[model samples]
Target: MMTILIPATVAAVLGGFALRIWYRRWKQQRIEANRKVEAPNSYYSSRGVRQQEDRERWHSIKVGTLHPLNREEVLRLLDVVDEDGVSSLSRKDRLFLDNMTLPRMGV
Candidate 1:
């Protein structure tokens, strides 16, 4: 009876652990499957209200408007963040980067 109980208990614990791991992987896959993305047909036109908004956005990002975080400065800031996490940034650096817009790729 003792020998039988030991083997059964071992099997039950191992089976439960395997089931837990499987369940976590399944949950992650389910979350990934349900993730949201922008619609392909979504469109914005540069006219009327949109035109004015774009102008304002451009003005807001204009030099002398922000704290002198140019494209090169922003790139260096990103490199620092990559090397030593966001927490390593100075308060001023964090404020500057957080408020600045992401640069256009291939620019």
Candidate 2:
């Protein structure tokens, strides 16, 4: 029984060591592969940066009036305005729309 236990313990220790070595090698290989894959010109490169800047410039020009509605007020307004006409909308709906939409139009 003692002999069996000694060999079993030795086997477990060796198996754990083997697994650790295998994992280390696997991790190193993965890192090398990632480096090789990312060696080409990435989005952080100069040309990519220039392209991103150009996109931002175009977006600034084309950006129309976008009202930043508060989530709570927007939900409240949605609740007040049903499928009926604007006349059915509550005072809260009108106020919510006025507060949100006017500033965004640069009014």
State the local distance difference test value for candidate 1. 0.65
Position 39, candidate 2: lDDT: 54
User: Which candidate number has the best TM-score?
Assistant: 1
Question: For each candidate, how many residue pairs have backbone atoms clashing (under 3 Å)?
Answer: 0, 0
Give the number of colliding residue pairs in candidate 2.
0
- Which lDDT tens digits does candidate 2 get at residues 5-43? 999999999999999999999999999888845556454
Give per-residue lDDT, candidate 1, residue 30. Answer: 100
Residue-wise lDDT of candidate 1 within 19-107, one digit each (tens)?
99999999999999999987654464435654344334333444555454376576676677667655566878766764675442232
Alpha-carbon TM-score of each model against the true structure: 0.39, 0.35
Looking at model 2, the pairs that clash are: none
- Candidate 1: residue 61 lDDT (0-100): 49
TM-score of model 2 (CA atoms): 0.35
